[model samples]
Target: GTLLTSLTEELPINLKQLDNVEKTKTALTPVFTQFQQVLEQVIAEGKFTALPLTITVEGIENYLEYRKIDFALGKQTFFSDWLPKAFIQNTAQFETVTNLSSSEVAQRIENLGSGEIKLLSVRVDSRNIVMRYSR
Candidate 1:
């Protein structure tokens, strides 16, 4: 009860008052800061264990979902429109490298004649690439 009252006082804006995406985005920083400060205070005063504390803020999920949509739309717009224009404007600084033929690569390796060649085993998974070097 005391913590709730302290959080209520520390928060700049009431969570219930944020009706739109813009308001929620604007309040996100302050709300997060207040919650973090309150949690830190509680931990510092030895009221709760910091290691396994799970503080759930109601209605924050809605704001996070809206923000996620906003982020995706912004990313799409940036990649589709702004990035192309920027690349076109800076074309001189960017160079396109042609793919080398397998024979050409083999010839280059042959030219390096009798040197120790290290082989690498690569494994590609959905989330990561694991590469192991073999002598």
Candidate 2:
């Protein structure tokens, strides 16, 4: 079944938006990890169907100006500005994305850490991206 969904979550990453404010890896997780770690706040929105899940991050304490993700269908029109060049070069699956089983992700996460997850819970429903963490 084909579902249609369009939602705008433009609220800042403040206490009001995130009820249980804690260590969250928003859509900007990779951006934060690969680029700037000083940003404590940002904004995020995904078109649900867009293959690459467009993520936009604006001024967080005026660190950087406008940045946008251009993805239409099953391909990213352009690599994220801050996306490490090594990432693009080292990307094993460039032509397509491989879906990893939950157990696979869990096992890999466990291997990377001492049985802890970055995003404890991640799911999509009613055209929304929901997440939770172990607090």
Candidate 3:
């Protein structure tokens, strides 16, 4: 949270780069290429289809990077509108949002209490998820 707040304020932050990125790239390149090929084929079919692929990465959460991937399904789907609209509606419920003051947020961070705790300000606009903390 502190790192996020610092970023909002344009303050310098200390971050450690993940080592051996080249190694990871070299290992995953072939798999990624194959995956791309599969997606291209599926897209070319132009059918109401769902493709499932599972990916796992190590030590990414601790890397202090914020990443969001959003794609519109309407452009790719054979049917018009309904699937994409439903998809957008379903995901809006999962955004972590909070209205607490920054001091209360700081206390939550300080305590690091057990079990599930979410303190954030999230906005979902046009099906795109934007997350901000103390900005």
Candidate 4:
């Protein structure tokens, strides 16, 4: 069986036109209830020892700003402490090679023998050229 499992829950809130916190909370209450129910069922089942959960609330920045929720203690801390610590496990996989020319980058890619090579990022000065290679 695969180790990773993805679950996406779409909340009924327009990210572009966000309302007050109370309204947002009210809108999310049902989805949160569903999540709670699923979690409770999982707990009752006794299927796994440790379950790593990652919740990605899209457009949360706008909502946070709209709600005037100040993260006095940095974003990373807020995410790890407040949200879920499991997120910390999701480390960046791409490798960044700085100060490389376009031809150098091409050469590097060509050298990486017969695998899927993804060009994550590329800049003019080649300051932060990120690449990910997988076999």
Q: For this target, which candidate reaches the highest lDDT against the unseen true structure?
A: 4
Q: What would the per-residue lDDT of candidate 2 be over residues 21-109, giving only the tens digit for each residue?
A: 45344744555554332222111222222232212111112211111111221233222111311112211111211233334433332
Give a tens-digit lDDT track for model 3, residues 2-89.
1111111221222232256665565556667766666666456432242211111112232122122112211222222222111132
Clashing pairs in 1: none
lDDT (C-alpha, whole model) for all candidates: 0.33, 0.27, 0.29, 0.36
**In model 1, which runs have C-alpha deviations exceeding 4 angstroms?**
1-5, 9-19, 50-135
| Per-residue lDDT over 76-117 for candidate 1, one digit per residue giving the tens place of the 0 to 100 score | 211121111111221101111112332332233234332233
Candidate 1 vs candidate 2: the TM-score winner is 1
RMSD of 4: 20.6
- Each prediction's TM-score versus the true structure: 0.24, 0.18, 0.23, 0.29
> Local error of candidate 3 at 22, Å?
0.7
Candidates in descending lDDT order: 4, 1, 3, 2
lDDT for each residue of candidate 4 in 1-135, tens digit (9 for 90 to 100): 112333577767788546578778877788778777776765454322322222221122233331221232123211222222211222222222123343454445445343222222232233222232221
Residue 37, model 2: lDDT of 28
TM-score of decoy 1? 0.24
* Residue-level lDDT for 16 in candidate 3: 36
Q: For model 3, what is the C-alpha lDDT against the true structure?
A: 0.29
